[model samples]
Target: MEDFRKKLYEDIIIKQISRNNDVETAHKCIETLSRVVNNIIDSPNDERKRRLKEKSKTFQSNICGAQGGVEFLVKIGFRAKVIDFEKFYVLEHPLTDNPDSPEMEKLKVAQEILQDFLKKVKDRAELASKMQAKEKAAEELRRKAVLEKIDEDKERRVAARERLQARRKSQEEQETTINEESNSADDSADTADTTDTQSQPEQFYRAYHSSHYRQPNQKQD
Candidate 1:
């Protein structure tokens, strides 16, 4: 019968406790059991450590009300008892009496299991947190890089526009200077043509007079 009870309680710890509660609550339940086991192991002769009040708020919230909580205590040799009209679960055989017994061995194994589970859960949470932080930092770097690229593109466009505008202004100034020089050359050519036309009229008059007034000595031809 004791062996059967131990088997039943072990199954409860392995399956029911985690199934019935959220992870935080489940861990709390396991931690409570660990403390209880540690207390019993440390003070096997302490009557207080051997007994748990059924109606106590802490016991009800952390242990009795939790699935498989009562069963786990039972597996370690605790039994339901009534004392002075109040109810309690009391250890019948203090595990310290026979540390090498199967019950004591089972208790130690259960403690080991609980500790291992808690450590694994803690490690997983830390790993997840670190991954999230790394991802966030990477995202921030990507965002900054994108913004910098945009700014660089904008600056290049502005510089290109300014250069284009400067080139256009220089071309316009050169055209203006060439047009002014061409106009000055055209004016000088026109003035020289007018002066030549005036001189030609005076020369033509002198030639006509000289031809008419030929040498008087010359005989009529």
Candidate 2:
């Protein structure tokens, strides 16, 4: 509830001064430790968690509030020093010590445990960033390739459609031409038949008049 940011991340251990002396500083120190622990707990980086399990990477672990650690610790005026992470055990440090002892050895141990977790997470950050960059590059290349293929397919479909339409039009024209030719032939045949029928009737009538009219001369004789 109080302003804990003043201490950054440290538990109030045995100072050279009395415990009651600089009492506000002690409360703020507790607040900072609480905040820092929460931040480490909810890390956004997944690779950090993986590395922590495998113990695959090297890190300069430390006791926070000591010296020679990350800038975040140094900025807060603590004597933090980075040490070998293998020697530190988070389970044994912060939670297991006697709370009311005059020598706050437990507080110092908590600081060390907290620092190790930070180092582990920070070590994996650079690698995760590089991997994300590589994945982004690959995705961009794949997107461009797919778009190009789609364009090529669209062009091919358009060309095929045009060819089919032209072929159908050609067939229709050929059919129209053949039908017109057939109609013309039928018309010519009908005309010839009509002309022959008219001529035969005319010739028969002329022959009948000529042969019958010859009997008129016998009456005069």
Candidate 3:
């Protein structure tokens, strides 16, 4: 792979010489760009390097090499101006020194910009995790609610079945009582009819015997 840092620095130097016609400013730019490249290249064990490697695999984004490092800062809202030349893009950082050397100030701004970009990435990840947690909570609530509704419906069905069984049992008891009463009444009527039939025959025999004896006696007299 080509050294993108060298390419970018060369482009910046060329543009600075031609457009601004200032070797000192161009040298400053070169130094600053060199420092950025070194910070990234030298720190193989840095957390930023590890994160960028992971990001490159998962997404088409990275902050590792010069090609994506400057672009990444710009994308994350760093106000470093980019002058588009015919063949290359040169980054322009404002030279602001407040009690600090210009080189120190430029380095500080670049560091702050990179740190802020990292913070923004962390914030985005945090927000996404929070949203996922909320969605999971909502799903759990919906699942619980559905289970509760199912339980309630099951209880209602059981209660209704019990009530129906009780009603059926009540109806059966009433029918049994009515049948017993009707059977008792029929038994009483049968006993009264049998007594009347037996008594009439006995009364007829006694009256016939007494009349025969009385006729014999009157004839004798």
Candidate 4:
């Protein structure tokens, strides 16, 4: 497929130079034609390729097809002219004894310029693909880091909740212990007060009876 495309590009260059002998014009024509060629090369559209090749052979006047023989020469800025297609001047350009021909010289110059252009385009595309891959890798790393951070935060929160629960449980137990001790102390104080109250009444009653009996005995004496 790659070889086919290279041959196709070379054929288009030859055709463009043969028709107009202008490299700049030929380059522009190829620039427009590259889109269709690249698509066919990438996707392998047989029908499209066949149609494009057919279009290349047919000419409006003297101009060749700009893109895969489908696009018109006038569309690519070429003027129409009525010429005998059978008796056309076959100036063998870039690869013939007539290398010194003005048209052939133009073809050579155009070929060099287009080769450089295509190379730069290929290099830029490769660079773009690499950059996109790097971006995707960085994004994946960022996503993983976010997930890890979320897990760490969840674990920390769970630990914090457990610690809080434990502290609350301990505080509740301490409070319960204090309340029980207060109640026991209150009960002991109440029991002591009741015992003192009962003893005091008994002692008072005995003293009163003894005093009354002793006074009567003194009067009899």
RMSD of each: 8.5, 15.9, 14.5, 12.0
TM-score of every model?
0.50, 0.40, 0.45, 0.48
The 0-to-1 C-alpha lDDT of every candidate, in the order given, reads: 0.78, 0.44, 0.47, 0.50
By summed lDDT, the worst window of 10 consecutive residues in model 2 runs over 49-58
Model 3 lDDT per residue over 61-108, tens place = 222222344443343223332233222222233232242744334445
Candidate 4, 81-175: lDDT as tens digits: 22444322121212333657443344344444456655554565577678889999999999999999999999999999999999999999999
Clash totals, every prediction: 0, 6, 0, 2
Candidate achieving the largest TM-score? 1
Task: Rank by TM-score, highest first.
Answer: 1, 4, 3, 2
lDDT of 3 at 189: 90
Which of 1 and 3 is ahead in TM-score?
Answer: 1
The weakest ten consecutive residues by lDDT in model 3 span 57-66
- Model 1 stretches with alpha carbons more than 4 Å out: 1-10, 121-221
User: How well is each residue in 60-176 modelled by candidate 2, as lDDT tens digits?
Assistant: 322222232223333332232223543321221122234454223333444454455345434545566677799999999999999999999999999999999999999999999
Question: How far out, in Å, is residue 77 in model 1?
Answer: 1.8
Clashing pairs in 2: 61-83, 65-79, 66-79, 66-80, 67-79, 67-80
lDDT comparison, 1 vs 3, better candidate: 1
